[model samples]
Target chain A: MQKVFEKPQALSDTPFAYCPGCLHSVVHRMIAEVIDELGVLDRTIGICPVGCSVFMYEYMECDMIEAAHGRAPAVATGVKRMLPDSVVFTYQGDGDLASIGTAEIVHAAARGEKISVIFINNGTYGMTGGQMAPTTLIGQKSSTCPGGRDAAAAGYPIRVCEMLATLDGPSYITRVAPVDPVGLTKTKMAIKKAFRNQVDGKGFSLVEVLSNCPTQWKMTPVESLSWIDENVVPYFQPGVFADR
Target chain B: MTTKKILMKGNEAVVRGAIAAGCRGFFGYPITPQNEVPEYMSVLMPQAGGVFLQAESEVAAINMVYGAASTGARVMTSSSSPGISLKQEGISYIAACELPAVIVNVQRGGPGLGNIAPGQADYFQAVKGGGHGDYKLLTLAPWSVSECFYLTALAFDLADRYRNPAMVLSDAIVGQMIEPVELPDKIEVNIPPKPWATTGRKGRGKNVINSLWISPDQMEEVNRRLQAKYTLAMEREVRYQELAVEDADLVLVAYGSVARICRTAVDLARSERLSVGLFRPIGLFPFPTLPIQWLAECGKRFLVVEMSHGQMVEDVRLAVNGRAEVIFYGRSGGVVPTPTEILDRIRKTYGRSAGVSHYRLNPGPEARR
Candidate 1:
């Protein structure tokens, strides 16, 4: 019998504690699938950040190091240098990667560190209560910004893919979302490509995933996907910003 | 190759010692007094086929060290007062994760962005664990240029032995001073494999190195394990040098460069027929407390001389445990106490009428005649 699909061997048997409608689980599955496809699960090491997916190590069947908030890239940089032949990657959120860790991410990218970066941009701080993150939209409401994110006060959202694309260090930079089934397929392809680039000795590959936070967004799981397709896809303009 | 003596500065010797100790990674930022450390590493690391990175900031540098050490690599970082303060966060994180690494703090006067000159003010920061949390660094204080070379290597050993951060606490005086060091042509450092290191699981099970203990009971257990290791260190790692303490009635307790100055004062006091000796502590954290307590029980009075405003004096007093009188004399804000001034203070401790300090006891260049 041809088994069309099964759980990825790279994913551990531990169940995820993520909230309902959270796309982090999907992203995690995609990463696990990518690792299995590459048959490099044993040779891969992961750096987890201080975010909703901080416990990503609990689900990944590989060597993992939990980095201090916003420090996954720097930690990954260290691991990659120490074990150059091993595949190194970082799992980070918008708050961890775009806000507090801006310097680490920017410099790691600029240094052309040979590591893969999986950046989850959900527009709001998830681990801590929903706060206005650097990617929060102008009219988006968060716990910290009661009156919705004011462009005049909070400034505009950061387009990390476009911003990081300017740096010549990174060989591959793309923006993807899994708001729907078709989008999920695209996001998986982007994540797999990023991993393959590292295996091929390509320096600094990042895939910014526009994830959904249904609970924080005060929307149904179904509505969240619809919101992402209408609002996020327009603002973020998902596609590869750089590749070579 | 045979070991031979070579003239070198304390800062340069520290790099040489690290190289000889089989260090493979160095991430550091530039700060005064310790700039030579990074500058030397920049040239030495590449030559030695190691990694040397001048990180963007001290915080970044320490984090990089944390990263490298997580992979079971022998890595280090060196900085001064202000820079070390910035590294406190990463230091705390590393301690929590139980990663082994060496951190060198070349002492400089500070409260803010203080001057680059030497100071003994960092004694409390080094020994008492400058960073936040229930952690302690196996702090080693070096008094001479040669010790600056040797102790840096010892620091790496202590770090890996207990899987905790080891600090080599030096001052600007020792870091800048030039002296002869015995160098070995090649060193074969034998260490056990880091079973916890995340160097790709391969055939082995996945390794997850972390310090985020969310549960109360689990956190307590983690802390208990750390305390047990610290207890083991205290029992075996306390190192100090006692000079002429068998018959001496007065003992001067000091560390780092201050101990060297106190040694000179001890000689001057002895020349003046005063009974003064020196107790130089090498391990500042596991602090030779029992020896000082023994001296206190022997009815020996202590005078703690420091370049800070009575920082280590409290520790000496606590160790003395009210057995004898413990007095403190210090000069803060980068001011170094002369041997004559220290001798004067010693004479005053014995209830003798001593001449004024700062007045040259010898009519030499500092006579101001």
Candidate 2:
């Protein structure tokens, strides 16, 4: 009998505790798969943030460090600097990357820190009971913004890839959505490329993953996928903003 | 081998000491009273084949220290009072994760950006778990430039030995003052094996450096383990310098730069025919409580002098346990008390005359008012 597919060797047997229909498990799988494909599982270290995927280390087979809320980039920088030969990356969410940790992330990119960043922009704060995130849409309703996010009051959703693309430090900056089969394929490819860039000694590669939080969006998993295509995709255009 | 002595600022000695102690990574921000630390590290760290990064902020710098230390590398970060406050969050995480790192607080005046001169006001913030949560840093207080060089190396050893963060709680005067430091050209630092470090876990099971224990029972277990480690440190690492405390009627309790002044005041008090001694706590966290208690049992009075409005006095009072009178004389807002002023305070308290003993005495039941 031929074995067609199996779990990535870099992924552990631990079951994910993510909410049903969340894309965190998918992204985690992609990152693990990339590590296996690169054959750097033994030399790969991960930094997980204080978000829905805070336990991302439990699922990854490589050595991992859990950073404080929004400090994953700084932690990754430290790890990468100490172990220059090892592949280092940080897994963070919109809130973790754009809000409280904005200074850390921006400076990390500006310093041209040689590390990969996997950013999940799920529109709302999924773990914290659907609070308004920095990437929340103008009309999006969250626990904090009960009446929908007002652009004037809450400011605008941050386009991290676009913002980072403006800096010369980053070698690669891209946005990808995994709401469907085709999008999922591209998301995985982007994640792999981001990791590959780090392995090649390229500096500050980031892949912003446009994901849907079904529970937080107050919709079925299927409905949330469609909601992302209709509402989220247009605001956050999916493409490589920088690749150099 | 004969070790040569060099005249260097306390800030430069800290950098030199870290390098000598096998510190391979240093992440810091430029702040006054301690800027020279990062400045010296910037040139010396790379020369020593180490990493010296001027982080964007103190928060990022400490988190960087966390990341570097998680890999079992001897890493450090130095900042002043305001900057140290910014680092409290990362410090808490480092403590909780049991990461071995050295943090230097070359303290300056501050409740909020008070001034850039020297200050010992951060004593509470350092020894009392400045960050949220129940944790302790092996805090070392150096009274002179020579001690600054040596205690930093000791801090790295102790931090790694216990797998806990160690703080070099220095003041601006000690950080800036240039004095002769008799140090070996290259110290042979013996870093213990760190099987827990996250160094890619080659050919072994995956290693995870984390502080978050989701289950309450698990969290309690983690805290119990940390507390046990702290207890061991307290037993094995209590360091203090006692001068003339045996027959002295009044013993002055102090640390850091204030201790140096107290040392002079102790000499001056003895010259003035008063039996005053000095008890300088070298390790602030594992504070020399036993010695203070022993002194209190011998019916000795205490006068705690600090650069702040009385922070370490509380610890001294706790050690005394109301067994004897504990007086506190402090000067805040970057005012370094001269030996004469401390000597005068000592005379006022020890002489027991009714001639205006303005310093607060007996930090217990009747002294609350």
Candidate 3:
């Protein structure tokens, strides 16, 4: 029997840690697939931030460093600067990137660091009990914002791709979702392009993945996928914001 | 570049030592007292084929060190008092992950952004595990320019030896002061390969350097191993210098820049036919507790001198266990006592001229209480 699909060579055989319906698994697999395709699996270093994907180091076969919350960009910068020939990337969540670690991410981008960033925008803090995040949609209910995200109190959602597009430092900036087959294919392309940018010695490149948090969203797997398309997509509007 | 004997400031010596010790990366922010360190490294590191980055802030600087250190590189970061406080969390994470790196704290006065002048107020912070964790960092206190060069080199060695962060705790006086130093020959240090470092996956399995262990048993095991390492360090790494302490009835206990001043005070007191001795600690974390314990058993009174309001004295008091009286005299808020002022305080406490009475010194009655 011919096998139609097999695990990417850049992924370990260990079981994934994300929730059943969470899109973290999809994105993680996509990143590993990209590394394998680039034939740079052995020389790729990944900086995993504190979030639901905190254990990303365990799932990937590449060298990994677990960074403190929001500090993954700075860590990635350090590693890339020290080992210029090696490919380095950071995997961060919206809470980790846009909230607590805004300074590090902004400065890392401004420095035009030669690295890639895999940002996951799940619109909520999935690991920390579904708390309202910086990218949390207005009128969305979370553990902290039980009354739903009121713009008067919580402000508007942050569009990381668009915001980073304004900076001349980054060479490529895009947003993609993994809710469906078509979206997943687009996300894989974006991830591959971002990795290619780093391999080509281009400046910073980032691919923001608008993932879903089925467990945190208190919805079924099917409902969560629809939620991303219905509400999250309209606000986040996945697309290539910039390609320098 | 550190070829032969030359005159340089303590801050300059730190950079020279780091270069000689095989540091390939230096990340730091601009802060007072230690500003010269980064200023010097910025020019020198590039010349030596190393990386020198002035980070956005002290916090970011330490995080940068964390990134570089994860690759098992010989990296370092320098800062002052308030800046060091900003680095505590990052330092704790690095230690918890068992990464090898060196951090230099050229301390200035502080509770908050105190002053640029030299101060030893961070004695507790340096030795007492300033970060929140069950871990220990090897700390070195250099009192002179020569020691500054030697200890910084040793700090890099010790950090690799223990697979932990090592701190070179200095002060403004030593950091800014210029003195002659016989720079040692190019010392070749052997860095054992850390297979656990997150360098690339080439010829090895996946390496994950992390501190978080969600499981209780796993976290407990990690903490237990760290505590054991600290105990082993205390047994083998406790360092101090004892001067005429065997027969003296009074001993002046000090470390870092203040120890240099204490030496002058001891010399002048000895000239006055007073039985004054000096006990200086070189490694502050694996503190010289045993030496003080032995001296206290011999019925020797102690005068704990520092630039802070008696922080190290608490450690001394614990070691003494009431075997002898442990009195303290310090000057904080960026003020350093001269040799004469220190001598007066010594005289007030153990003055043979006044028949060893319970008299007080200047800063006088308020400090006495």
Best by lDDT: 2
What does candidate 2's lDDT look like per residue over B1-369, in tens digits?
347777889999898889999999999999998999999999999999999999999999999999999999999999999999999999999999999999999999877988998899998889989998889999999988878888999999999999999999998999999897787788778999999999997979999999989899999998898899889998999999999888788899989888888999999878765678889999999888888999999988899999999899998999999999999999998989999888878766644632424322433212321
Task: Say which candidate scores most in TM-score.
Answer: 2
lDDT of 1 by residue, B1-369 (tens): 557777889999899889889888999988998999999999999899889888878878888898899999999999999999989989988988889999999999877888988888887888887888889999999888778878898888999999999999998999999987777676667666888899988878899988887899999999998899899999999999999888788899988888888899999878766678999989988988999999999988899999999988998998998999898999987889999899878867665313434323433322221
- Indicate which candidate wins on DockQ: 2
Ranking according to DockQ, highest score first: 2, 3, 1
Off by over 4 Å in 1: B1-3, B352-369
Return the TM-score for candidate 2, rounded to 2 decimals. Answer: 0.96
Write candidate 3's Cα lDDT for B128-243 as tens digits.
88889877789999999888888998999999988889999999988999997888657787878878877798998888889999999999998888788888899999999998
Model 1 lDDT tens row, A1-244: 9999899988999999999989999999989999999989988999999988989999999899999898888888878887889899899999999999998899999999999999999899987889999999889999999899999898999999999999999999999978878888899999999999999999999999998899888899899889988998899988999898
In CAPRI terms, where does candidate 3 land? Answer: high
Worst 10 residues of 1 chain B by lDDT: B360-369
Q: Cα lDDT of all candidates, in order?
A: 0.89, 0.91, 0.89
Each candidate's TM vs. the true structure? Answer: 0.96, 0.96, 0.95
For candidate 2, list the clashing residue pairs, or say none. Answer: none
The DockQ figures for the candidates are 0.83, 0.89, 0.83
Provide the lDDT at B243 for model 1: 94
Query: Higher-TM-score candidate among 1 and 2?
Result: 2
Report the lDDT tens digits of candidate 3 across residue range A81-184: 89998999999999999999988988888888999999999989998899999999999999999999999998999888888888989998999878889988
